[model samples]
Target: MMEFRMKRISRKFSSVLAVISIIIISVMIFSYGCVKKEEKEITIGAVLSLTGKGAKYGEAIRRGIELALEEVNAEPNRIAKIKVVYEDSLSEPQKAVSAFNKLIEIDKVSVVIGPVLSNEVLACAPIANLKKVVILNTSAGTEDLRKAGDYVFRNRESAIPQAIKIAELCRTTIGIEKMSIIYSNSPNGKDYQNAFMKRFEELGGKILQIENYKDGETDFRTQLLKIKESHPQGVYLAGLVTELAYILKQSKELNFKTSFFASAGIEGSKLFEIAGDSAEGVIFGSPAFDPASNEPLIRNFVMKYRQRYNQDPDFFTANAYDALKLIAISIDKAGYSSEGVKNTLYSIKDYPGVGGTTTFDSDGEVIKPIRIKIIKGDQFVSFEKQEK
Candidate 1:
């Protein structure tokens, strides 16, 4: 009876010991897999407006990122080959939220670089903050993006700087004593108009007229005629590339030959295509990389971008390129984790990039100098920089 009892006790003890050993081995294996996963692959995601009103800008951003990733992946000493995944937000806020959720929950990306429009960024940025993912917005310039979250960062300057620069250029460089303004009825358009008017008047320049049209308005003959009646030396037009192009075309049709000063939104080859000869001599503040630049980094980037896309790169391209490079720099400097990248991004300063010397301020807004350009013939030539 005693021997049988001892045998039962020995069997129970052996069974417990076996279970403990299995659990330890399973935990060790799981931890090793996680370490290997972190060391091998880094996933990045994007929520871009590939099929909506913001498609052109989004496509440019996508191309820039692709070019940058190609170079990054080719580096032999790279920590991990970055894998990018994209979801089209269609430039809609609700769609952008869905895309953000998909990237964070399904794709498991540590960082995201898009949602190109300001409205889209506004929708997606808070979710990124909650989910502990880093978001780098390439070109969304609305002041609303500034309030998104600490995880939100922008690569382009907002309308304030561009608007102020335009006002200064009209006053100092062009010597314009009187200006008429026309803007689209969007948030950016309204904000830019107010900024330019405030700064221009403060500089002792007169605003003769202020006109506005809806975003998709086709006929601007009334506004153009009113602006013509003002007889201002300079007409400041703040709008998207398409709207500005249409305005230029219509203004030319109305025989309004007054010199035009536009926002950076008009800085692209598409404007010339739409407005043709009407785009000539149109001065605007541009964030584009100078085509006549001799800098090696600028030259190399331009060559590669042109070769890949078969066209000249614009500010959108340059800013997007810088965005990806900044992300990579942060990842390398502070590891691939979300918190690590977020912390490192704030520490970056004086990053001499092809776009400009990029440095993030306390609000995660990029501070870079913008150049004033004149649409001379078939090209945009650098007229000068805003006087201090």
Candidate 2:
């Protein structure tokens, strides 16, 4: 009878152990299912000039976007997997419109990043506003882009700040009292010209001469000769990089020794490659792009960009990178809806970006510090106020 009692007690203990095991297994399965269900996905679209005239800008933007997407995906606590679909705008206005439509209609993307040039953005902005979609323009810095509507936001500041800064640097740092302006007869060039002239005159500088040339014009001997005859202390050239390079080469041919100031348009390698020796000592205002910045965010981005592209990141790439980061941040805060993203964008402030800390202003424009860089020797260096 004692042996029977011992066996019965052992059986009861076994039954309790099995019931606990089932309960633990049930809880484990439920937790696993919950985790699987929590995984989310989002799709963003990019409409860039992937080919034709604006290909270089598009390529930089694409690289930045891809880098941001990778970094976001690798975050251990990230709830959503982000993806970007790209459409080539060919740097044409109509093509940009079509690309924008395709991204919204076909890909069903509520947010898009791109159409890098001003004209492309202008072309696509109306449609975006109509559809109530959100657009984060990476590098379109034209003055009129600020009026593109509430749904459109740009990562880079408008050309006005660079113009003002360039003028200030020329007058105060370079000690220039008189300057000449040569600009392209395009919207981009016209905007820079107006802004610079207004700011320079306001700062007590004399505008000795103003000249304009049509876009794609290779020969600038006439304009350069006219500018040289003005006897100005400096010259500000505002136009595309290729044109700027040719103008520089021709200015050199004319033995013009005046200081040279360029628009942010001259931010690429093409200017140096084509102008060669003429590019030395040329100063321009760009969104700050110092890879040696103390901010770890900037340092890491610089390192990753260099590692992936095997080249130094420029202001354009930095702007695109900031745009992507802002978009991701908006998505996290506002969910995957277009209206949510648009609302969050306006509220973003002090966003630490590789370009600079960005704060979106009331007009959907970005406000950030612009750096004055001089091409010293073979590289661009930030111009210090104390440096002679």
lDDT of 1 at 277: 88
The count of residue-pair clashes in candidate 2 stands at 0
lDDT by residue for model 2 (1-388), tens: 9999999999999999999999999999999977875576788999998987678788888988888888888878766888899999998889999999999999999999989888889988999999999999978768899899988999888888888889988887668899999998877788889999998898899999999998678999998899899999999989877889899988999999889998988877787788888988898888866876868989899999989788888887888878878888888888889999999999988888888888998878888887888887667777764274
**Could you give the C-alpha RMSD of every candidate to the true structure, in order shown?**
7.8, 3.3
Tell me the TM-score of each prediction against the true structure.
0.86, 0.89
User: Which pairs of residues have clashing backbones in candidate 2?
Assistant: none
Evaluate candidate 1 by giving its C-alpha RMSD to the native, one decimal: 7.8
lDDT of 1 by residue, 276-296 (tens): 989998888777467568899
Give candidate 1's error at residue 339 in angstroms: 1.4
Q: What lDDT does each candidate get?
A: 0.85, 0.86
TM-score of 2: 0.89
lDDT of 1: 0.85
